[model samples]
Target chain A: MRDIHTSAITDAVKKLCMEANWNLEPDMLRAFDRALGRERSAAGKQVLQTLKDNAELARTKRIPYCQDTGMVVCFVELGQDVHVTGGGLYDAINAGVSEGYKEGYLRASIVRSPFDRVNTGDNTPAVIHVDVGPGAEMKIMVMAKGGGCENRSKYKMHTPADAAGAKDFIVECVKTAGPDACPPLVLGVGIGGTFEKSAILSKKALFREIGSPNPDPALDAMEKELLEQANRLGIGPQGYGGDTTAFAIHILTYPCHITSLPVAVTIECHAHRHKEATL
Target chain B: MSVTTANDGIKDLSTPLSDQDVASLKAGDRVRITGVIYTARDAAHGRLAPLIEKGEKLPIDVRGQIIYYTGPSPARPGDVIGAVGPTTASRMDRFTPALLRLGLKGTIGKGYRGDAVKAALREHQAIYFGAIGGAGAVLSRFVKKAEVVAYEDLGTEAIRRLEVENFPAIVLYDCHGGDLYQEGQKVYAREGA
Candidate 1:
């Protein structure tokens, strides 16, 4: 077994947190710039330009790209062939999130109780979804979701009587959402899972990069169709009206109960601030 | 007290902004507004609407002032405010007309307002500027000073008087019923144009 110290893991998590908060991934930059080129609306182009300028100012001044740095979500792939030499691995990851948010000046957006909210101050207790796999190394992906679009995500059970209905429902949600999700959104569609599983899957769908397709042939085309339909809404960037409201639509699907086809849609705004690292 | 950007015909809020000043602005231009701007979101607007319904004196006099729709994060050490960016503007749909009659001059936020607000802006000679949806940190550079002036119980949701400089925003709706968002969308909307 490859023995990893608890402190080493914790240190890695903390550094990853700081880096994710302070830096906008180059891939994200490329996506925005690329989208700008494909964008047809003058208004949409201007919105993208402001985003580009914000990126320049954020990088030069060491400021956060967006104010809502978002709640910390970590997708951890742990290796069964590895052993921890120090404290437990989960503890290390949590500690690192706390330390990173503090040191990086990221806002403490989480609260223990959702109804009667109180600031956690350190942005602690990261929501970690861990999957154990066959390897000697661990991998972590970090995501910070802004609240503007976060409020607009939706999940519903559609009857399997009509196969196309599922896709239709997803398109309506995007149209109603309009420019509210900050436009040029990343659409994560989780299909066929049970209710909560579909929700989680939809969020995980955001982990997919811009313009990537699902592995399934039929579903991949479905993703492409939905992306085109959504852009047609003319809710342009930031809802100002333009040729692009969505840059990509990613679908993640699994088998569900025979009677139900549940679909969840998660919207990621243009400021898609997420990063991945290995331990 | 006059911290400005663009160095143009920027004027104070307490005094009237001329019709010429409002007409000169194009959608994408940037301006740093010095002086007092009030803060309110859905919840705060709810409270203000009822007070206005009774024809009661508002907790704060809002005549000829700019209203920002934001719920900022709590500030940290040596900082005047946190990432205080614009919230979605459509939610204020029902209440803006009454406030417009009460002497409001401008509104700031992300997303577009509906017909009611657009009519109110035209009838009242007011303007609506759309701030960048996600650029809070860069936008924070303009808000040099802030203080809670009302609804202190709302915490970060409280109403504030933010003194800003050269705050950059696109004029989405103007006094003449011109909407940049609508015009821009028509040009870029994905029809077979």
Candidate 2:
């Protein structure tokens, strides 16, 4: 059994929060380059170039890439054999979030309650998901999910016979979101799970490298088709209109009850910031 | 600040835009704004309307000025302000008409305005411009100066007065009811798909 200290977890989360905010991952940079090559609209190309430049500037200046540093979403794969010491897992993660947002000069965008709408000041109490697996290592992945794109995410329950409608539903969601959700989006599609599980799966799918193909051949083909259809909508970069509305579409699936065909689409903006570390 | 003229096809605009100035802009016109604009997002807008309804003085004179829907990150020492990008504008649709009625010349944000906002722009001779939504770090370079003008307790949501130079934007909605989002989509949307 590998004993991991909570302090180490806290330190990793803190560094990941700041690093993810300030720097664009290589996959994201490559995706930007790909979009720049194919974008037909002058305005669209200009927006793409500016985004690339912005990424570089943020890295060099240690500035948060976007003003909305986003609410941190974390996924942890904890091994049964690994024992956590010093504190509760959640306490450590939240401590890291609070410190990272404050120390990194990132925005504290969380509100204490939806109704009262008071600022949380420290951007804490992250949305954390944990799965226990057989191994001696603990893996932590983090995503700074922005509220604007999160607001546009949607889920649908289809009768098993109507599962084919998933593609159309995703396209419709993008159409409805239009320019609001920040086009040049990366769509994470989750298929065939319980309602809530599908939503979580969709978000988790976004942590995959931007241009990488899904491991499953069937899901990989579906992603390609959905991506093509979404881009054809001409939402473009920032929805000013162009050929590159979405850079990629990633799909994940789980076997569901015979009656259920649940699908969820989680829209991610171009500043798709995520990072992971293993302990 | 010296203004860049329209010779290269980009219009140079300044704050406190006059009626004629607003009328001259059209949907899809690229522009670079120079001079001062104010920042306000959800929380700040919530406060402004109550003050207007109460017939109380606002913390800043908003007449003929532009409001950017933004909540910037905290600035590091030696920086004027941190990554200050426009937020989703539709969230402010509820309070927009009121400000437009009070001589608000334009608003800078990302995304579409509602039908009522379009009507208000037409009635008031104002405009709506969109900056690249996620390009906050690049946009911050344009903001040469920034100061919290009101509601400091709201933190980043506080109203800030910013002096910008050559801040790029595209006119999304003009006073004449031209809508860039609609027109651009029509032009670029693949036929028969």
Q: How many residue pairs clash in each candidate?
A: 4, 0
Best by DockQ: 2
In angstroms and one decimal each, the interface RMSD of every candidate reads 2.9, 1.2
Candidate 2 per-residue C-alpha lDDT over A1-279 given as tens digits, one digit per residue, 9 for 90 to 100: 999999999999999999999998999999999999988898889899999999999999999889999999999999999999999999999999999999999999999898998888989879999999999899999999888888899989988888568678988888888888888898888888798889999999999988898999988988888788888887788989898888888888999998989999998998899999999
The true-structure Cα RMSD of candidate 2 reads 1.4
TM-score of chain A of each: 0.94, 0.99
Q: CA shift at A74, candidate 1, in angstroms?
A: 2.0
C-alpha lDDT score of every prediction, in listed order? 0.77, 0.90
What DockQ does predicted model 1 obtain?
0.44
Q: Write the per-residue lDDT of candidate 1 for residues A167-272, one digit (tens) a residue.
A: 8888877776766778878878899869988888888888877766678899888888888888887878887777778888888888999899999998788878
RMSD after Cα superposition, model 1:
4.1
Q: What is the per-residue lDDT of model 2 for residues B56-131, given as tens digits with 9 covering 90 to 100?
A: 8889887889999999999999999999888999999999999999889999999988999999999999999999
lDDT score at residue B149, model 2, on the 0-100 scale = 87
Please give each candidate's TM-score.
0.84, 0.98
Docking category of candidate 2: medium
